[model samples]
Target: MNSKLLARIKVDAYCDKHLFYGLTNLNDGFDDSRIKYFSEKDFEVVLERVKSLGIGIFGIEPWKNGHYYDCKVYESHTSDPTDATWYMTCFENFKKRGDNIVYAASYFIPKKLLSE
Candidate 1:
């Protein structure tokens, strides 16, 4: 996507408390363990065709902190916690049954704003 298109999308997605990006891959009715792992070379050869499609491709990873079961949908269905795509990712199983819940909040602005 071009800068103009991306800018417009981000603006609309992040504009208000009642708005958010709804994205998910869970509940496919199949086991996620069946997902395969590929080497970098394997992926480069496989996905090379999509590079010319002029689309943005992203990957998901877990936040360092947090203790959810399997998936963490950043913003809830009704925007309970906060409104934003936030960061969607998986969580590892706790070492003990009584582990404490933790959270580290931060924002990632693409560019630094300059003073006028």
Candidate 2:
């Protein structure tokens, strides 16, 4: 990782917070509660990192309040809410990312993903 890049890299704007890449214990409560958000200086940097790793981001999930990302009105929902594991099934491929991320952004990136 470039020192200059690290210096400018804030937290990922998608997840509630920037989590150190790892297998976290997602409790049974609200999924949002298990998330921690982070700040970012350049979305490009984040995009490059994600693309390099070929990360597949499923769609965002609505919170307990029925509000979508950023607490927006729940006029509609992302993917099917029926299956507990069906959330984040829709893959969102970004051509480019912005410096600041907001709205429709409860995106969660696992620290590391491994295939069995």
lDDT of 2 by residue, 48-108 (tens): 3444544423333322233333332112443422322222222122213322332122333
RMSD, every candidate, angstroms: 14.9, 13.7
Model 2 error, position 99 (Å): 11
Please report the candidate that would top lDDT against the real structure. Answer: 2
Model 1 lDDT tens row, 65-103: 222332344343334222322232111222233433322
After the best TM-score superposition of candidate 2, give how far the Cα of residue 54 lies from its true spot, in angstroms: 1.1
Model 1 quality (TM-score): 0.21
TM-score of 2: 0.28
| lDDT over C-alpha atoms for residue 23 of model 2 | 25
